[model samples]
Target: MTIGSNSPTRQGQLSVLLAVCLAALILPLSFSGAAMATHTIGQELGGTAAAMNWITNSFMLTFGGFLMTAGALSDVFGRKRIFISGVVLFALASLGLSVAPSLGILNGLRAVQGLAAAAALAGGSAALAQEFEGHARTRAFSMIGTTFGVGLAFGPILSGFLIESFGWRSIFLSGTLVGSLSLLIAIPRMTESKNPDAAGFDWFGAATFTAMLSLLTFALIEGPANGWTSAYVLTLLFGAAAALIGFVALENRVRQPLLDLSLFRYARFVGVQVLPIATTYSYVVLLILLPLRFVGIEGYDEIEAGLLMLALSAPMLVVPLLAATLARRIAAGMLAGTGLLIAAAGLFYLSRIEIGADTMALVPPLLLIGIGAGMPWGLMDGLSVTLVPKEQAGMATGIFNTTKVAGEGITLAMVNAILAAFAASALQQAISGKFNGDEIGAAARHLATGDLARAAHLLPGISPETLAATYGTAFDALIYVLIAITLLAAAVVFGLLDNAKPSEEEANPVVSPGE
Candidate 1:
């Protein structure tokens, strides 16, 4: 691609891209790796079910909350300043995570990692906007998204090897090495820039918005554990609701808003936002879900589970890039919509396979889902960049990423809660009144996470065979919901995003080799 050409400007451009992409890998690698590492971490750290959930949740809460604020800060302060600071902090945090003495300390470090990740991601992305133009910008943003997919594709395998060979701390060790390299590459080569017209920080919007997401996630994650109708969960839900209303009101009144609520007026932007939420259920949830099922229920060991995930996620290596290339000629909306329907079909295929089914039974559907998810995943960052004016790149990408990451975080929590409920119901019916609701819910929650040891511990009297069957039944039902979500997203994305192409006058010509 023209991005890697030897001209001095091109060389500098490539350096910026490389640094950002490398930094981009840390989030997905840590996230997908942590999901697979849950049991191993618990074995050493004495994790409770709640603590196990927080392994991912704690990171995402801060990550999702701080993204927009970080982006706006990048635009206000120098992007290079924020970017390098974030990278350095991220490296230090990873080093701390490797030797943390307990789950509490480990989770605290993860939260700090999320805060640093937000700064690194927001600052670096905005900086790259200063370096590229037109089609180059499109490709640059797509590369970032693809880099993340690549991390997701390989994270489980890497974590499994690191954990089995050197223990869980090595996962954090691996991240530290990567962060150090990202910081090194970025320090000398990356340019510093910011929006001249951008105003002071929107503290009210920031505080209210972050508070809303933090409260909502807490409610969702705790609802099942505390009982949905429990006073504790209900109060959290109320606080989250109030915070949301306050956030909306505050955003409308603020001069320089953290979120700029007016952006939703664009049909294309709305369509673009939908893409991430849709993929969360269709693709991201599976990253957490499949590992649990394979390792916990199917009797696959950690490495085997990671290998099985390879079939589901390896298309990140090729398919997303293919989708981006295809977007040049085809309507991107049509491409995304068609791909999601393919995913819905794949989910349906997956729903039929029984427990302990052979690899061939699983591989085909997983591949289809990976291929389907690849299309929308590839389109996100590019569309986000194009929709807003270049000056607001920090805010635009920040909001887009916040939506993407926040959606995944909330959706993961919701999917787990829903699956636990569905599995609990299935367990109750399958066993013909052997257990009460509390017992069933406890077992289902653990089983849903693929913590077979805990699930068994929760239901000492229940046969392992019965628990496995119950989980299998719940998985089928959950897949049905995912299928509906994908299909709905397909239609909605197409309807809103079709005919969203730029006018010929605004379109840039593809660059030629001689130039």
Candidate 2:
């Protein structure tokens, strides 16, 4: 059924479409709010550092792994049917999360939450595409894009308020309320849409791809903690490589592949795809790392940290809308590349800040980061689907989001590993000739959590100044690492994204034969 066709029931399409887009907004709300509440959850659950990381990673891994398969399922079944199912599943998982008894159960429920999210996002985006056309479709997507930025921009603050007043469980409970409302609206107003000639499911391809992401994440998160050369770590790494190779081969041979390998031929599309990965590697890294630094070292509460985070996210609300407006007048590739360059500059500025720098000192760099983040956030999603045929919208949206969450999970895990190693190295270097092994070991454990007072207790003979300096050195090292990676990613973006404007045909969704 074409969008806006004069059918008896089509009058409600606008409300149903907006409801789906708003449901997409709920995703980042939960994820980002969880990020803000991670420390509290860990303390309450008596979870170790590694277990805490798993709370987020487990969800991301399954979300990314199941995205394509879910999108394909929607294509075969019906968008409305799959979309509603996803909402119900997501709501149930969130409700379960609010009352989880242990860290293990919470992690399991998070994975279930991610799977449901995959189904909801894929089906929702596909439905929106079917419900709107051309300029109207772009505007609908723009609203979705704006919701995405605003949700992320405000998530930490919202989560902080809820966690402060009601506890972290309220975050999940809030998501459940929103999900139920979406399901209610979607059931009656939403029309069912699917590809009439959708191909059969490629189960082998899906399995191999899922294995690849899962094994790769397992290796990255576990390797540093378990000793990189340990048998289990090495096995996971090699298994991931094998799974990746198997997935590629299977996709190439399959009649109906999970991913269309041919899509990579569009240099612009490849360039657009890379932006999310780069943004997560750089911008989201700060989202995860900065809160820890603020709370652990700077002596701030969760509420204060969230307020500080607002400095980093606030520009996201305005800049994406601005960037979206600019896209019509400028080439998208250049705009995205420029945005990355600005973000790299922001990262460099952050690296220059002293370890004892107060929250006030962070505002300028945070604003820069937010603006840079918004620029690409504005264009990448719309550009991703525009480059492909409308028939492939579901798959494209799936891959697009999978890259985002997977990149975020993988990069955050890597950063955690880096922080642990660097902090230890800095601690040892600071006390090289001045402390005994027992004292040093105690200091190192305290330093791992950025606890200067306790670490100083272990080194009673040392001056408070020396202990403070040692912690500062470790914090500075992380900033330097982030700076280096952001710069490298910017250079990659500049070299890869094409500066030429796409033609009208390339920019619009193709009317597939079935349509």
Candidate 3:
């Protein structure tokens, strides 16, 4: 059932590669809807800000924790078998989520969905890496990147429409259709790629690694919410540190470790691995903040806001295809580094937005951000695995995926905390100011609707105008902080990375069973 480099079945293998990549897109679609739904529902359910945070954080924790294990299993067993299994599990979980009766049940199902997604994601990348080589492989990776950009750009808009038309439940049900299609394509087309000589599964290593990752993510996400110095936070943080040390020690001694620590010795691998975390950190901050600002503050409906936010993703859809062509001609490191700079510039432009800013005002900044984000999104995976030995491709890909998810999870939580703190501070200042209380209240009401009624009740005193000014200033402050973060990310890229082409010695390292 294995595919040979020059086998007559290569065309069939390519079809399977396409199916696997498309299936990977489904998870993001489902997830984008679920994340937004949870936030909206949490607001309705009287859940505090922290509860809203967990809706996405929980899924990310499970997704990031299992990636290494999934990649290890793909290398040990077979990518096709694991991918099919994952699609089935993912569909079932979506069904469970569609019928979930409570937030607790829904959250549990989301965690399961993340686990299944990790399996599919890891297996799909491994399959592509195994199925093609050289220029063909580059094209395949580029297309995969394009799908990712399209998914990110389209997921929120599609989800918003579903939620608006049929409620949040429809979002999960829609996933069932996608999962079914991917499974149908997968069964006949995908061929197994198992290393028959690979060592047995490293159950101990997997378990320890998952435990360590889960604890670390949990601490990072929950710490600020609970007060970073709280006893519970401290305990989780210390436990995470200890588990990580233990996991590293176990990997060093294992016959088939989940992660090959030696991969870090390659500069390209390290650069690609860390670059996504920083870039995604900046990207997710915009993803979370913009929609809230547009819909919550600007008086736009969910659907309208979703459409407006498309500005950020539109270039993402187109730029990756262009980047794929560029990667073939230029140094991948230079492309990645240049992409980070472009994104940083976009983030800085977004920092200029004011309280009453129009969608038109956001369009230019978003276009820049989109292009910047898309370029590296296209190349990170290729850069990561290409720098490692062929035998260790699965491990390298898994690490790359893990870092990206970890970045998204930690950044989402941190950005939310920052925005909440700023908004609350602004609201408090508005409330405490000396003014005709009735007049100030009226002004607040008018601003909420994004309108200025002619009625006398709509008019506000000088203090109310000051309050309005304060809110705008607060939002601007947060944007500045985000801009600084993006800049720092770009600096990290330029400082830490080298501009060398990937080498054959690094790409085909020695195989030790699961190596």
Candidates in order have lDDT scores of 0.85, 0.76, 0.69
Model 3 — TM-score against the truth? 0.86
Select the stronger candidate by lDDT from 1 and 2: 1
- On residues 1-515, what C-alpha lDDT tens digit does candidate 3 reach at each position? 23335678776876776687778778678656765465456544434345555667778778888887888888898887777777888889989988877677777888898888888888888888877776566667667777777777888798889888988788888877888888877788777887565688888888887887777677666664565688997888788788888888988998877777886665545666767776675576667656655654555666877787788877778887777667656765677678877887887787777666777998888888888877777777666666655666677778888888766766666665555455445544655665444444434333322222211234434343454455465557766776676677666566544444333323453323221
Determine the backbone clash count of candidate 2.
Answer: 0
lDDT (Cα, 0-100) at 385 in candidate 1? 76
Model 3 residue 92 CA deviation in Å: 1.1
TM-score against truth, every candidate: 0.96, 0.90, 0.86
How does model 2 fare in lDDT? 0.76
Residue 483 displacement in candidate 2 (angstroms): 3.4
The candidate maximizing TM-score is: 1
For model 1, residues 1-515, the per-residue Cα lDDT tens digits are 35755666887788889999999998898888888887778778987677788888888888888888899999999899999988898889989999999999999999999999999999999998888877778889889988998898899898888878898899988889999999888899998898899878888888888888898999999988899899999998899899999989988988888888878876678888999988888999999889878877888878888888988889888887888888877878888888898888888989988888897789999999998998888887787777777788899889998998888889988988889899888888886577678887888888877777778887778778888888999999999999998899999998987754322102622212211
Candidate 1's error at 149, in angstroms? 2.1
Pull out the clashing pairs in model 2: none
lDDT of 1: 0.85
Ranking of all predicted structures according to TM-score, beginning with the best and ending with the worst: 1, 2, 3
Clashing pairs in 3: 389-507, 389-509, 390-507
Query: How well does candidate 1 score on lDDT at residue 47?
Result: 71
Query: For model 3, what is the C-alpha lDDT against the true structure?
Result: 0.69
